[model samples]
Target: MLSPLGVSYLGLDDEGFAHFLRGTGAPFASVGALTFLFALLSLGRWGLRVMLSQKHPYEPWLWDHSWRHELQDQRLTQLLVSWPVSLVLLAVLAVVHWLFYSRVFSQGHVLPGALLGLVLLGFDIIIFTRVLGPTVLGTLALLRFGRMRLLLPGVPLELGSRCQVHLEARSLARMSNVKVELRRIREWAETTGCGDERLTQSVTHIEHSHTYTVDAAALHEGKALALPLELPEGGPEHSTALHASRSCHWELKLSSEVSSVHLDTTFVLPVYYVVGGHPARAS
Candidate 1:
C-alpha cells in the first residue's frame, strides 16, 4: 500500500528504532562500568599522590592555608565518605535487576516498565552519589572550616546571663571609616513541649547595644573593641529562663578609600544565668 520512497523511509526508521533498543543494554552497562572504573582509578591516583608526598620534604611556610586548599581537603573527605556507599548501592541495583528479570521471564509477561524504571533509578543514584551529594557536602564542610569558631564566644555562659563580646579587625594603611553591626540570637522553647508563654515573650523581645567605629591605623594593627551586653533585671522564672545566649554577628562595610574586604568571625562567650539561678536544660 505504500509508495517505494515512503516504504524505504519507514523501513529505515524501524531499523533505527530496533538498533537503539538492541544496543540499550550495552550502552547502559558500558557507561556504568566505565564510570565506576574511572572513579576508582581517580581515587587510587589521589591516594598515591598523598602517600608519595608524605615522604617528600616540606616547608612550614608552604602550608599557608587558602580557599583552594580548603576545597581540595573537602573533596578528598567527601570522596572517602561517599564512595563506599555508592558502591553498595550499585551492587544492590544489580541484584534487583537480576531478580526482576528472572521473575518477569518466568511469569511470561514483559516488564518493560520495570526495566525502564531500573535504568532511570540507576542513573539517578549514580549521578547523585558521584556529583551532587559530594559537591553539596564538600561546600558546607569548607564553609564551616574557618568560619565556625569566629562567631562563637570563647567562654561558655549559663543561660539568662550577659557577657561582653569583642570585635577585632586589621586594616591596611590606606583603609579608613568602617561601619559594624552586631546581631543577637534568642533561644526558643523546645518545639516538642507545650509552648511556654513566658519563653515565647522573652525571645520575642529585642534589645540592641550601641555601635563603635575603628580607625584605619587601629584596624591595620588588628586592635579589638569590646561592648557589654545587658541582661534583664530578673532571670527567666522557674518555668521560663532567660533565653538570651551570648553570641553576636558582625558586618563591616568599608569606605571607598579602603578595599571592599568582608570579614566575619564568631566569638565565644561564657554562659550566664539571669533571674533564674540555674541554666535551663536544652529541650
Candidate 2:
C-alpha cells in the first residue's frame, strides 16, 4: 500500500519501513547523489576546456599541452577521424556478441579450455587491428607527403640566443602555410589527497612559446625550410636532472595546411643556459 506521496508505505510497520528505506534508496540519496553530481561537474570542466581550445587555435594555453618526447605521426590525427567507423564496428560487434556468442558461452557443451582460447583469440584480433590500422594509415600518409626531418645546428642552443633550425623535406611548393613553434613546457608530479587515497598526478603547462610562419613560395626549387627562433632570456632554462620531480624542457612543433596530407610532428629540443662558460646547474 502506498501513501499520498507514493513513497510512504501505509501498511508497513516501523521496523519494516526502516528496512525498506535502508535497502533500496537511502544510501544513494545521502551519498551517491553528491558523488555523481561532482563527477558531472568535473566532466563539464574538461569538456569546456576542449571546446575553448578548438575554437582558438592560436592560443596554446587554452589546451592541455602534455609533454611527451615520443615521435608523433599523422596516424594520431587520423585515428580521430576514424572514430565514427570504429564506433560503428563496435556496435556491430556488440550486437553479434549479444545474439550469438553470449548464448554459445552459456551452453555447457563446449570445453572450458576451448572457450578460453576463443576469448583470447578475439582479444588478439582486437589488439592487432588497433596496431595495424594506425600503421597502414601512417604508411599511406608517408607515401603521399614524403618524409621530413628536423636538422638542428651542431652548436648547442643557449637560453637567450637566436637559433637556426632547418626542415629537410621535398615538394614544399605544394604545401601551404608551413608553421613552426618552439614551446617551453614545465611539468611536475604532485601528490593529492590523504594517505590511503593519495593520488599522484603529473601536471604540465606551456610556459613560453615562439611561433613562426614560413612562406612555402619563398623556398627555392629544392631548398629546405629555414626557421629562425629567438629564445627568451627571462624564461626558465631546461632542467639538468633527467628524473627530477619537476623540470622544464623545450620542443619544436611543426605543422602545415595542405589539402590531402599535412605534416604534424614534435621534436625534443635541447636548450641550455651557459654560466661562466659552463652550463647552469640545476638545484
Candidate 3:
C-alpha cells in the first residue's frame, strides 16, 4: 500500500488497487521501515563506539564491558539482549508477509505489521534513553571523580615499582576533628596484598603540618596506612602530604557533626634510578 510515504499494493495486475496501495500502504511501510532502520543503525553505531573505547573490554556479544560489569546494578544486560531479539523478530515477520503472503498486505495485515515495527522502534529509543543513556552519564561522572594522578620523580612509575607518595588535602574549613586515613588496595594486583595498611598520619589542627615516610616496597607488597586527623570543633583549613612506596586505594570520611567540609587528596610518587652503583632520581 502506498501511503504518503511509499508504495504498497496487493497485486500489480489491478492498476487501481496498486495505485491506492502505493498512495497509502506502500508509503506508510516505506517511511516506517526507513525510520526503524535509521534508529537501528544509529544505536548500532553507538554500541560500536562504546565497545571500542579504552575502558571497555572488547566483547561483541555485550554492548560494553563496563556496562556488563554494572549489569548486576541495573539489569542492563537482560534488556540489551532482549531488545534486539524483539526487533529482529518483528522485522522477520514483516519480511515474511511481504515475500510469501502479498495478499495479506491488502487484507490489512501489512498496516498492523508496520505499526508493530514502529512501536518496537519507539520502544528501542525509549530503552536507549532510559537505560543506556543514564548508564553512560554515570560512567562519565565516575571517570571524572575517581580520577587519580600518580606523580613520579619527573616520570611515571611502573605497575610493580615502589615510589614515595605525596598526599595533600585541600580546603578544610567548617569542619571539626577531621582525620585523614590512607588505605592501600588489597585486592588489586598492584597492591602487594597488605590489605588495609596504615601508611601515615595527619591532624587538621591550626598549624596543619604533618609528614611521614613509608617503604614503597612494603606498601606495594600489600601494606597500607590509615592516617586519621582529628579536626577541631570549628575545624581549620588544612592540607597534608606523605611519602609512601606504592600507590594504594584511599578514601575520605567526614565526621557527622562537621558541616561544609571540603577535601582534596593527591598521591605523589618519586622516581628512583640506578647510577654509579647508587639509586638516584632520574633527573
lDDT of each: 0.40, 0.58, 0.35
Report clashes for each candidate as comma-separated counts.
Answer: 26, 0, 48
Residue-wise C-alpha lDDT for candidate 3, range 146-264, written one tens digit per residue: 32222223232222234343322222233223233332221111323355873443322222223333222322333322232222221100111111232222222211122322223
- Please tell me which predicted candidate would have the highest lDDT against the true structure: 2
Stretches of candidate 1 above 4 Å error? 1-165, 168-180, 186-217, 227-234, 237-258, 264-271, 275-283
Global lDDT for candidate 1? 0.40
Query: Which candidate wins on TM-score?
Result: 2
Question: Would you estimate the TM-scores of all the predictions?
Answer: 0.29, 0.53, 0.21
lDDT of 3: 0.35
Residue clash pairs of candidate 2: none
Error of 3 at 268 (Å): 16
Model 2 per-residue lDDT tens digits across residues 178-214: 7888888888998899989999998988888889887
- The order of the candidates by TM-score, greatest first, is 2, 1, 3
Give the per-residue Cα lDDT of candidate 2 at 36. 77
Off by over 4 Å in 2: 1-137, 218-220, 235-242
TM-score of candidate 2 to 2 decimals: 0.53
